[model samples]
Target: MTLTAILPTLRASLPEPVDPALWPAHTETTTDDVLVAAVSMVRLAELTGTPCVHTAEQAPPRYRPRSWMPRDVSVAVASVLRVRRPRTGVVLLELDAVLPPFAVLDQVRLIGRVSTAAPTRTSVVTPYDGTDGEPFHRLPAPLPADVREGDLLCFPCVSAIRHRDVVEPVRAEVSR
Candidate 1:
């Protein structure tokens, strides 16, 4: 389906506005990258119903139908776990933890660092944290040789989740 047709469904599925504390800090970057990341965020939001925010500048010129966009457009862009590009290696890792919705980004950070490549460049596909008692979704069939599964991982909870330093190890069900 066209993006316009898909947008409404995406917006409707998203959870409540993402907590500001969990929002990624926007740094000065090229418009093209921002646009790509914005679109990626939108797709991710559509899948998980996790709220994401992107700046006006990041909005793609071609995606003109703004009415159906997800909420909190004014907040900083959500952190990109990885960007898929030719010749760039991409890894998908499942986050296994009952993370608060806001901690998703932090979990992304942690998985990025521990993976074979840098988190900034690697794609991390986190599992639905068990908060909703959702059954773990399996990684795509015919997984890559580089992809690892059933690996335990951990990272510090975002400050919003706890005032003190709480080192938590979230099990990463899959890694690529």
Candidate 2:
């Protein structure tokens, strides 16, 4: 089956405006592969919502291949806000915020309701290089402001931490 068959008129396709750099080329797939991924994505979409689920499925297949990181996955806390012209409001979450780990970045899927009546463009925080072992991350341009603060944003990491090296823990010693 072709991609058109598997996608079957996706409601929320990937964001087309972000720099080409944010997303990698989709892994070459056979009809069977697309079907499998599509099926999995459908289930995921049902749980999350149409937009997020569609974005997850469109991500390069290689990004989500089953894998584990040496260090545990952690997230940084920050409120979503509106940025300047290029940047829109998105959750500026840092993964492995304190420590660096090893693994590939996973795809991010976002879900939100219409905050504004008009259609607005959107963007999200994606790693600079998803293939790299470093933890440094960056945000894409022109994220949609349509989503309110409470909306959920789910997507893969822009990149992953390395699994080979040991991450040093940051322990705060308190003296009484």
Candidate 3:
């Protein structure tokens, strides 16, 4: 271990401390690692290897259909997924939303109807399948995206978060 690991003050004084709110509850940063649910992420990486996904054990929040989305955005990504092709068990999502910012083109998830399990996007849309009407290129989606009968689709603010991280000198919108 390094000297910084030995001293708590050095760890506490991070030049670029990660925002805890960006992650799950009970997430904290040590000098050398981020801990979720009291498990050390760095330690896990040392044992298991890097690019490791650490799932913190926590009670799932009871989310309404539009619970996680922003007030300005409206979801039109379809409530339930339908099998577009029988053999492959494929589902297609035609993106059409009331708001421009809400019409997410990629990196989307189909939240489980019965459970909170969500699957990430699988493939890019082919030209024959897409629509000329809207900017969205229809996606031939994740085979097992935990899609259920009443599972509503959600657009996580991943892009906004990414923009915040990647872009510099950002202006926070303020209203009087």
Give Cα distance to truth, residue 57, candidate 3, Å. 27
- Candidate 2 segments whose C-alpha is farther than 4 A from its true place: 1-109, 112-138, 158-173
Clashing pairs in 3: 113-151
After superposition, the stretches of candidate 3 with alpha carbons farther than 4 Å from their true spots are 1-78, 81-83, 93-102, 112-131, 134-136, 139-146, 157-176
- How high a TM-score does candidate 3 get? 0.28
* Prediction 2 global C-alpha lDDT: 0.31
Worst 10 residues of 3 by lDDT: 158-167
| lDDT winner between candidates 2 and 3 | 3
Error of 3 at 101 (Å): 5.5
Model 1 regions lying over 4 Å from their true place: 1-88, 104-120, 126-147, 159-176
- Can you write out model 3's per-residue Cα lDDT over 69-171, one digit (the tens) per residue? 4322111222332323323444444222222342343423332222222333333222232446543345423323444443334332222222222112334
TM-score of 1: 0.23
Q: What C-alpha lDDT values do all the predictions have?
A: 0.31, 0.31, 0.35
